[model samples]
Target: MLIDWFTVGAQALNFLILVWLMKRFLYKPILHAIDEREKRIVAELANADAKKAEAQKESNEFQHKNEEFDQQRAALLSKATDEAKAERQRLLDEARKAAVALSFKRQETLRNDAHNLNQAIRRKTQQEVFAIARKALMDLAATSLEERMSEVFTRRLREMDDTIKEGLADALKTASDPVLVRSAFDLPAEQRTAIQNAINETFSAEIHVRFETAPDLISGIELTTNGQKVAWSIADYLTSMEKGVDEILKEKDKPIAKDEPKPEEPKPETKS
Candidate 1:
């Protein structure tokens, strides 16, 4: 090919212009868009990392608060348990003390009642015994000897003053119809004669005397005027003494009623 300097220069200039236009309009704009996109992605990644750190800090704080609450609850429960146990023990102790006091009071009351009862029984028994003895003595004295006793009775009557002698005379005069005297036992002949003399002397009248024997007098003399009679007996005297003694004992035992009680005995005291 023949060499052409002007034409070649013109073509090379045209190619250089085309390359400059393409770089400014198409390639240059595309490279600028890519650089902008890369810058936005870096900013978004940094924002996400900051949000994650804040969330981790909040979680740690919540866990710490929960642990503190648990510890407080545990302390409160322990205190309540201790208080409950103490209260229960106190109630039990008070109840036991009250029960013991009640028991002691009941025992004292029972003892007092028993003592009073025993005293009542003893007093009643003593009164019964005295009454029985008095009745027996009075009955025995009512129906006994009278005959032989009249002579001695009239003799004693005559020994009294004239007034007493007159009284005896009147009493004997009324019975003079019955020459015989009734007695619990027989008298000796001498005793009979002596009694006859006394009766005649006291009455100022010649009075006949006779003797009758009876065994119911119980060691005492009985005198009968006709059907009327006067008598004295050992048993009657003993009975009076026994009654007096019983009254005295009852009074003495009154003081013992305030004393400590006694247990059951062998038997009651013997009375005459």
Candidate 2:
């Protein structure tokens, strides 16, 4: 076991050279490859994280859009409901107005029919009554009552109101033409004299007179002077008759009311 320094030193130097060579070629290259692989893995993980974030953002946007669509749909539904209600009310109002108009038209037609019937009745009555009055007066004109008629005429003339008397007096006194005394029949000489005397006594003035027979006078007497006239005709009696007929017609047109309510008849009992 004697020590040999040269051989040991030579062997140690050779081992050191081998270690350097291995470190420079094998260890350094392998470590560099591992670092490169780790860097690549880290970059891949970062890319995956970015993709995840983008997907999350897109999901949130889709949810927000869905919510907005729901709100718009609800608003549209509400609007449609409101419009339907308004349309229904409008139709009801139109129907009500149409019904009212129809009722008014019915009432108006009824009133017109009643008025026409009443007028027809009035016209028929007037024509018949006036014709009868005219015939009766014409028949009466053939009688021998000239003196009495003259006396009646003078009496009527005297019965005028104060204002009428004054007017007649002025007309008679100032008239340039003679006063006219018309009758349905001729008068005798004594009757004419009596009438003249009555006129003078009633008016307290001398008035010129003219006598004439007028068949159209209808058994009446009339005096005319300066466009003023005093007359009595069968028309007076007809006026009274007309008034009586009007009262009767009014009574007939009135609805007769029952003093008591009408009793509802009892229904016959069934044997069952």
Candidate 3:
């Protein structure tokens, strides 16, 4: 190989100058543009990550809100259901009470009606019995009623005990007005005289006597003086009967107790 040092040296110097110019202008500019692009890409990637994170946070918040809304809705539904159930129970209780009250009222009305009917029947029976008794007595004693009654009055006066005699005597002595003798029928002169004599003998006192007929006495005699009265009447027996009838009817109207045992009737003895 021929040694050409000057030509080679000149070629080598020109090659170095070209490389320096390329590095200073093209390479450096290209490297800087690439670095800037890389930096921009990195910044964009970071921004995207941050945006994704924010989006994820927003999604989580939305999910939590949804859960909270669901819970509120469930609570509202439960509360509404409870309120409805409570209202229904309240109405049912009221209805039951109303029904019970109505039933009790009806029972009371029925009992009252029964009691009234029993009373009406009792009154009618009492009136009929009284009418029959009055008619029988009137028919049997038409002629001798007054005489028998006067004799009975005199007998009763004579039969007075010492206590009654003393009371009558005191009343006769204290009374400023005449003693009154009341009867259902007018007495004849003889009967009046007998009655006056009986009273005078019973009291052992001379007393003024006044006789009066009172139809309301109803086959009875009454002696009155100084607000004291001695009386006997058929009405007394009727009143006693009425009281007994009332007691029996009241017992019949009363309801029997469920727990109470009924009395058994006695059986007649059988012949052997």
Candidate 4:
């Protein structure tokens, strides 16, 4: 290499100028573009991250809402099932009550019918018995029954106790109206006189007497004064018979006991 200072200095100045030009126009512009690109990339990355976070939040909200909807559906289904069970039980109870009421009503109807039938039978029987008894008595009246009844009445009057005699005497004394004497048949003149004499002798008073025919007496004599009455009649015997008959019929109509033994029949005697 030639030792030329002038050439060296000139070449060095040229190299320095080239370096400055490259730095100002090419290198600085390239470096600035690279920094801007990096900043844009960073901004895009931040935006993407934000979007991902928002999506995740939305997914979480949707999942929570779905869970709430499922819970609401389950609650509704359970409530409906409970209501159905309650309704079914109510219907069953109502049906049972109705059945009980119907059974009671049927029993009541049966009892009423039985009672009405028994009453009707009793009334019919009583009427028939009374008719038969009256017919028999009326037939007996065609005989000397009236005369015998008069004799019996006189005897009864004679046999009256002191108490009865005193009561009749007091009634006669206090009575404003005449004493009424009722008989089933027209009394003979002798019988009337005898009755009057007996009354006067028994009471020792001049008591007025009024005789009346009463067919309903059925073979008896009845004496009434004020509210007091003294009577003797065949009807009394008939009433007793009727009562006995009623008791017998009631016993016959009673239900037999299941555990009671039946009566044994009488055995026929064997020829020796």
Q: Number of the top candidate by lDDT? A: 3
Model 4, span 1-272: residue lDDT tens: 68799989998999999999999999999999999999999999999999999999999999999999999999999999999999999999999999999999887886676567656655565556556655665676653555556667767777889898888888899899998989988988878777777777778877788999998886688888887777888768756766666576557646543447779898899999
Clashes of each: 8, 0, 0, 0
TM-score of 4: 0.44
Q: 1-272 in candidate 1: lDDT tens per residue?
A: 68698888988998898899989998989989988888878877887788788778888888898898899989998998999899889888888888888888886886676556545544454445445544654476552233323443654555667774555556677764655555555766766777778766766788776677766664455556655454555446556655665577668767877687779788988999
Where is model 1 more than 4 Å wrong at Cα?
A: 1-155, 161-164, 226-232, 252-272
Better of 1 and 3 by lDDT: 3
lDDT string, candidate 3, 16-58, tens digits:
9999999999999999999999999999999999999999999
Candidates ranked by lDDT: 3, 4, 2, 1
Candidate 2 per-residue lDDT, tens place, 1-272, comes to 57799989998999999999999999999999999999999999998899899899999999999999999999999999999999999999999998899888887886677567555655565556555644665577653445556767778877878898888899987899998988877877887888888788778988888999998775678889998898876556656766676677567656453346788999999996
lDDT of 1 at 68: 88
Cα lDDT for residue 87, candidate 3: 99
TM-score result, candidate 3: 0.45
Give the whole-model CA lDDT for all candidates, comma-separated. 0.66, 0.79, 0.84, 0.80
Q: Please give each candidate's TM-score.
A: 0.34, 0.40, 0.45, 0.44
